[model samples]
Target: MAKSGPNYKVNGKEYYRVSLEIGRDATGKRKTKFFTGKTKKEANQKKQEYINKQILGLKDTKTLWFAQTFNSWLFEVVKMSDIKPTTFARYEGLYRNYINDSPLACISIDKIEPMSIQRYYNDLFKKQKKSSSQISYLNKFIRKFFNYCVDCGYIVNNPCSGNKISLPKEKRSEAIAKKVEIFTDDELNKMLNSDDCKIKYISLFSLATGMRRGEVIALKESDIDIKHNEIHIRRTIATTAIFDENNIKTKQTIVQEPKTKNSIRDIPLPNSLKSIIKKAKLIRNEEKFKAGESYSTKNLDYLFLSERGNFINAGNLDKTWAKFLKNIDIPHKKFHTLRHTYATKQFENDIPLKTVSTLLGHGDIGITADIYTHVLKKQKEKSVDILEII
Candidate 1:
């Protein structure tokens, strides 16, 4: 509570004391520091020095350790932002896996340079054998972190501010990537009829609606309206690394909003599908009663459940799908192939591009266009046929 003051000594000498609020200690108690000087000016000067020391000390605490700064940004900035959990997890993963152990991690933020970062990336590609896309993701994280650094005034400018990272141009083999997998009609019917398909209804839902697996699992019974024959696209469920009670990161299933605004849509369900859903609801009644108090099903009237009457862990989907494929004597293909199959069927059925885009919840028509290039290529051939080209 005491303020700065100058005390006149008996010897006609002037001495001053300034109370510096150094904030609290580990406990909730307040801590204060006093600076004594031979003169008032000296006291003021000492107080200023203490203030700067405290500030620089904090700056060092954050900027000196790259991992600490990364976490600070994660908690203060990224987590507070509107980014999705998967996206936040992805950034965290990139930092932990690639950048955290880099030589740059030990250096102060202000001291890091474009060249140092560039060389770091180059080494990752050469020694670590990082792919272009993976390098690109790491570059993106660095850029975001450096931008945060600039915002915090740790650096005057972002070392990552210049030209966008130029990853090595991928060869055609890599750049082109693999064509999307689409299940044929025969394959779809085979899977549907196979008793070994544990997630048969899930596969059918995707094929009928072109919904993502995560989106389908996130659906609650409340989302389905049998009267209107409509299903609301609201949330998505994903299993990713999440921090536990003791701050230990662990893998868990998290339900969150859809990927994009357009992803939240309503689609009319076919009558047969509606009948199937009614039957499913009846089955879930028994599951809920069986699970009883142990059932962790909250307000979420989830359509699908494991044999244990719990939210289906989509993470196990790959292994489950593998078993299903083996049992059905089918070649290996991803579950997402069903979604592609749906989209392809829609386009092939002469559904308008925009209609298909909206139905698939694509952010833009271009994404639908890119994925269904087969439809466009066929249309081009039809154009040539119209002219009867020589």
Candidate 2:
């Protein structure tokens, strides 16, 4: 994720920006590293020196504000890393939207206390209307940064070190009301068979394999094994952060590796999707030969393409999903619900939790355990336990 370069303005003034990734954040989230200077050599040199200072535990000038410290640390983490662009984008958005303008960002780094941070989390949830998950990321950053300060000998103790700080718990009523969004088997059959179903192959493939939207779209002919009835999850296509010659940021199409270690898996194709897959293959081959030299994908083998032969983007896919839902007269839900639908179906059919987790490519088995096994947790309170609850 690191970029180093010099660029010019319209008037021909040149400046340089270099990014270096320093470390991970508290929740093991990736950090952002950014540095800019008037000269290319200076910027690059400063990036190296900054890395060295962290490695050697060098003393600072003692003038670091809370915001300044956070920014500096983020700059290092965002640079020169193997983390995904979507991940970097999330970290950047979290910092800019939630942390940068908070009261916590305005103080001296060493002066921050636990109560102040707790109050900030409360404000973020109660006043700012941020989700509990968002507050948790802020807390993660605060705790990670202060822990680093302690390691650097800048503070005697980390204010965010204790076990007392916790994220907002979901209300019992809200938890009860929250429903797992999924299409029933009957609904799925109707939707797939509907005359108005667009992107039929992709929709069916998602139901069969539980691939994410990005993974499904990024599919290439080379990734599929028609003979073996399986597909390899190697890469994903999405709109991600891209840096330009002028060191500014913009969103552009990117094809990158999968998310986690287990995310890169070989999923067996279900018998139900075989016909759809072959139909898609035939259409693509016909399109390729009909257009001949004019075919944009002649040199490539991507299975899905737009009318113009470009990769089908996520926005258009969602639009197609919406259109299909409208034409089928069904309530709209995220396409991700297909993955959930697959998992729920597997659980209902009595598949093992570990097997489900593996099929879903979850990094942690505990995630599968929590989402699929509703009764595994929350036993009746001991004081009010009822015999023969079943």
Candidate 3:
């Protein structure tokens, strides 16, 4: 081999090269840095940084590629924060899907371009069944990672930083801003007439008060005030995480306070519902006695419980709810649609927005407004009462 200056040739083009002319050294072994610059001096300087980083047992900032940099960035950036476990796991999934299989993994950091990054997203969107919001979130994550890479001098620019990939804009689906079906008085009465007393009470409570399933399960007898005719909603329970198809423990269940401060408010009870709940509470207590178990506050405290007298899981609630609907031979909507029905009825009856917002534990009136826009539009038109003045 011809010994030469820090310079080399590939075909006919010159590549500035730096090869460490030594064997094993104080750090470990010999290293070589090959780079293409307009000049040999630029290449030599680049080589020194590589050698320097190796000597110090650090990654060379100049030579890190997308694959290597992102791996490092996960630890360097995400691991240091106090992010939720679910959120960290999601970021990991995104990186595995987007950046792991690309040519960008081996492509030198300096060579990445906006066009390549745009294509990555375009491919992901085309291939995956993710929602628009999910894709936007993934894009934001990629853009941020590349921005960090640029700030640290691993790359010249963020390939994804300035590029705008058009995601399909999500208009309101057919269900949105549309008059959703709410149970009429007869329909509500038919559902209330259940053979299973547990299902009957659950239906009555949900319809009258509009508490969510999790919120309903988490409710304590102490949360209800018969004299005031009110039920307080303060907390919710949810499964910790969704598991993979393999049934591994993919996530933990969480029992925490309600999502927003407004979620902690009390709902005024209607006279009809107050009477039903009072009778149901008496029956629930009598069953506890017949089961021959000590009725501790924890066991009997909740308004609803399983036959075993434990707080009912949402799955149990769903199963029981489905069975009730099937036995009654009634058309059904999701559990949430019951709450939606309640809110819609309230809006149609001309109850104020602020009052409905508080009952539903909405974070804001805007969310309520968006969801019940169809109900509200109808109510607004009906408010004129043509016979009053004419």
Candidate 4:
């Protein structure tokens, strides 16, 4: 290969030359390829492109469009991975919403630059009024897709890397400043004491156990250990999409493993909650006897069942929760707030952070600390107050 040299004027036109080793010749001799450009940087870029093309074994890198590559990566690569179906659906949704018909999708994979990705993110933040967190989620997908491209030798560098793309500082600050909302004591009392029988037991169970709504609904009668006074969490119900032979998507509910290994755990049940469990079981038994053969055999062992004797649909549960809150004259909060309230109460009671994290089935103690930082801060203040007595 020729040595690198400064740009020189050729026939009154400025030009730069770069030499790169292509491969061995037929006689096993070293072979070099030369690239010429108007600037040294441009010459180096041309050489890098040639190396990328040879690595990909593609005669024309321009033939691979971003949209087509994304689709193929989703179905061929990501689908074959060990991710959950719901996750795959989320990936497809992101593609359809952000990348499917966009100008970035039409660009060749080889031409995608960090600036290109930065512009798309900026547009989403400014023009579409997307939240910083939403843009961050989109960035995660794009970054992973570009990483896959690099692993496949389709590209030399990820356009999303090196902190080249990001949300505005104000937007990022806003996101970080947002705090987790928990139910107030008054709101909790109203929910636990509400006359709405359908949501009452489940709401209390959530407050007691800090289990996610999906994990709570996926409970079976056998999961309740009356002898040990414990509740075992093993599975969760998730809504995912199924693609038919022609690629038509149909939504369905499925019982799958917990979100993380730590999510599968046992919680010590309070005696009051045990009694509530027994009452709920008795009521379900009475309903089952009345329904007789009409009762769904498939859902027999499940603790929470709909009127049709099927597992509770997560969507319907959300609606029921909303109506129950409205009837109780409380402001609407997401169902997840129940879980947050339980965690906050634990911290308020001075429970160990590791114990609270374990009960919540958080994958890491740091996650529990991060989510309940405000609660932890209040606890610290209380401890300092005690020290003032000295």
The predicted structure with the larger lDDT, 1 or 4, is: 4
Alpha-carbon shift of residue 25 in model 4 (angstroms): 19
- Candidate 3 residue 372 Cα shift, in angstroms, is 1.9
Rate residue 191 of model 3 by lDDT. Answer: 85
Tens-digit lDDT string for candidate 3 (1-390): 987553677788877765665356688877544555657888767667666656755445545767887877875677567654455567777777766776567776656766666666566556765556677887788788878866765555566665345554345674363555677667666786656477777777777788876787777778888788787787876654443434244655445677667888888877877667667677777777776564444557777666656666667777878888777877776777778888988887879998998899999999888778877878888767778979
Q: Model-by-model lDDT, in order? A: 0.75, 0.74, 0.70, 0.84
Candidate 4 on 16-50: residue-level lDDT in tens? 88898878999999998787887788988988977
* Index of the highest-lDDT prediction: 4
**What is candidate 4's local distance difference test score?**
0.84
Q: Model 3 — TM-score against the truth?
A: 0.67
Error of 2 at 15 (Å): 41
Ranked candidates (lDDT, high to low)? 4, 1, 2, 3
Best by TM-score: 4
- C-alpha lDDT of residue 74 in model 2: 62
TM-score of each: 0.74, 0.75, 0.67, 0.82
Q: How do the residues 1-390 of candidate 2 rate in per-residue lDDT, one tens digit apiece?
A: 868456643356667776776679999987877666788777788788666656666554247777777766665654446667777777667677766887877787656777888787787778777776667776776777777777776666788777757677668776545556789777897767776223777887888888988898888878888789888999888877765534378977778888888998988878877777678777677767777777785426777766556677678888998888777777888999999898877766666778888888899999777665452333212235356564
